[model samples]
Target: MGVRIQMLVALTSLLALFPSLTVTVAVMSVDLGSEWMKMAIVKPGVPMEIVLNRESRRKTPTVVCLKENERLFGDSALGVSVKNPKTVYRHLQSLLGKKHDNLQVKVYQRCFPEHQLQGHPVRGTVYFNSSLETHYSPEELLGMMLNYSRGLAQDFAEQPIKDTVITVPAFLTRQSEGQSCMLHRWQV
Candidate 1:
C-alpha cells in the first residue's frame, strides 16, 4: 500500500513539473539571395531560432516578365525562359549604380553601373512597364522585392509586425561607397 501511494505521488509530481507546451505562430522572413526572398512562421514564445519554414504554394522569383501582348508575369516567367533565354532576366543587384549613357542594356543581359563608388559595384537592370512610360530604378526595384517578402510575413500571420530585424553584410556601407543615405547620414 505504501509503494502504491508513493508511485501515485511520484506520477502527480512529474505531471506538475512539466506541463503541456504550447507554441505561438510568428512570421519570419529571410533573404535567400540578394534578389530572392523566403518567408516562414516561427513558433511563438520560443527564441527566433525555433521557427520552421512552411512550404509555400509558389517559390517567388525576383524576375519579372514583359510580353509584347502586354501580359506580365513575375515568378512564373522563369519556367518559360528556358525555351527563350532572350526573354529572361536574372541577378539584377549588380546594376544599381550610375551608368554611362553609351551603355546599352539588352534583354537577358546583366546590367552594371559604369562607375564603382565603393568596393561593391552597383548593378541592376531596368525593366519596362506595360505603359512603356516609366522606368524602374534599381533602388526602387530592390525595394519592391523586399516589400514583397514583408507582405508574405504579414499575410501569413494576418497581423502587422512591430518588432522587425533586417540582416545586412559587414561590408555593405553607403559611407565606404560615397553614397548618401540613412546609413551614411548617421555618423556611426
Candidate 2:
C-alpha cells in the first residue's frame, strides 16, 4: 500500500510539473480503390475532410508504375503505362488480405505475389515495368503515399503534428495497407 501511494504521488508531481502539456490527436482516413486514393485528416474537434494529391493533383489514382530506370511511379507513371502498358504499373489495394488469394484483378492488368511480401499481405506486392526493373514493395509504396498525405495534413494544421489517430476500412489486413490512411498520426 505504501508503494502504491508513493507511485501515485510521483505521478501527480510529474503531472503538475507538465500541466501545460497538450495531447493532440490526429486521424488520417485513407481509402484506396481501383480508381482513386482518398484520404482525410481527423482531429478532436475539426469537421473538415481534406482530399490529398496523387503526386500532382488533388487526388492520386490507385495506380503505380515500374520504370525501367529503377523509378517507381504512381499515377504520373500512368502516362508511361499508357505508352508502354507492359512497363507501367497500377492498382494494388485489392490484392491484399483475404481477397489476395484465388482472385483476379482484371481492372488493372498487373500481378501481385500470392503470398505476403512484408509482415502483412493486404496491400500485396506488384511488378511495374520490365523484368529487370526494380519493383517497389507494397509497404514502401504505401509509405510514400501516406507520407505525402501526412505532409498535406501538416500544411493544413499549420503546426508540428506528432500525435494522431488514423482510420482505415475494416477489411484491410496489411501493415502498411492502413498506414497511408494514418499518415498524420503515424508516429503513434
Candidate 3:
C-alpha cells in the first residue's frame, strides 16, 4: 500500500514538473529558402509532419503575382509567370533589404526576367513593380508567402498556429539578416 502511494506521488510530481508533456501546441517551422519554401509542424506526442500546399506538394515555389484586384502566391503565382511576366515576382530572398545597385540585385534581374526591380526612395530597398501600378516591397512579398505557409500549417493541424520558427542560410549578409528580422516582426 505504501509503495503504491509513493508511486502515485512520484507520477504526480513528474507530471507537474513537465506540464508541456500533458498539453500539446502546434508549432510551425518554415524553411525560407531562396528558390523554394517549406513548412513543417510539430505536435506533442507525434512525429514532426510536413505541411503540403493546395497542390499536395511538400515544397512551394517562392513566387508572388500581383493582379489588378488580387494577389496570388506560390504555385498560383508561378502559373501566371509566363502570361504576366512583369507582374510575377520570383527570387525575392536576394532582393529583400538590399540596395538597388547591389550585384545580387542585378543577378536576380537577369535570372528572373519575369519581374522588374526598382529602389525604394527613402530606404533604397529593392521593390518589384507590377504591370498594373502597385509596387511591392520585398518584405511585403515575403509576408504573403509566410502567410500562405502558415495557412497550410493551420489547415493540417486543424488549429490556429501562433508560433513559427524560420530558418535561413548560414552565409547571410547584414541586409539579409535585416530582412529576416523584418519577417520575424511581420509574423509576430
TM-score of each: 0.46, 0.52, 0.78
67-157 in candidate 1: lDDT tens per residue? 4444223456566565654444445444445343214433223342321222113443244332335444444444544455555666666
Write one digit per residue (lDDT tens) for candidate 3, span 1-188. Answer: 99999999999998888756444678999888887989999986779999999999999998887777788989999899878777777777777778999999899888877677888899888887764567788878877778778888999998878878788665455555456446646343
* Ranked by TM-score, top first: 3, 2, 1
Instruction: List the pairs of residues colliding in candidate 2.
Output: 26-164, 26-165, 27-165, 54-60, 64-89, 64-90, 87-129, 96-122, 97-122
Estimate every model's Cα lDDT from 0 to 1: 0.44, 0.53, 0.80
lDDT of 2 by residue, 111-174 (tens): 5332222222454444222334344444445556556556666676654456444444455565
The whole-model C-alpha lDDT of candidate 1 against the native structure comes to 0.44
Which stretches in model 2 have alpha-carbon errors above 4 Å? 1-19, 23-25, 52-58, 66-75, 84-87, 97-133, 160-188
Q: Output the TM-score of candidate 1.
A: 0.46
Ranking by lDDT: 3, 2, 1
Off by over 4 Å in 1: 1-28, 40-60, 66-74, 80-89, 101-132, 168-188
Q: Per-residue error at 3 for model 3, in Å?
A: 20
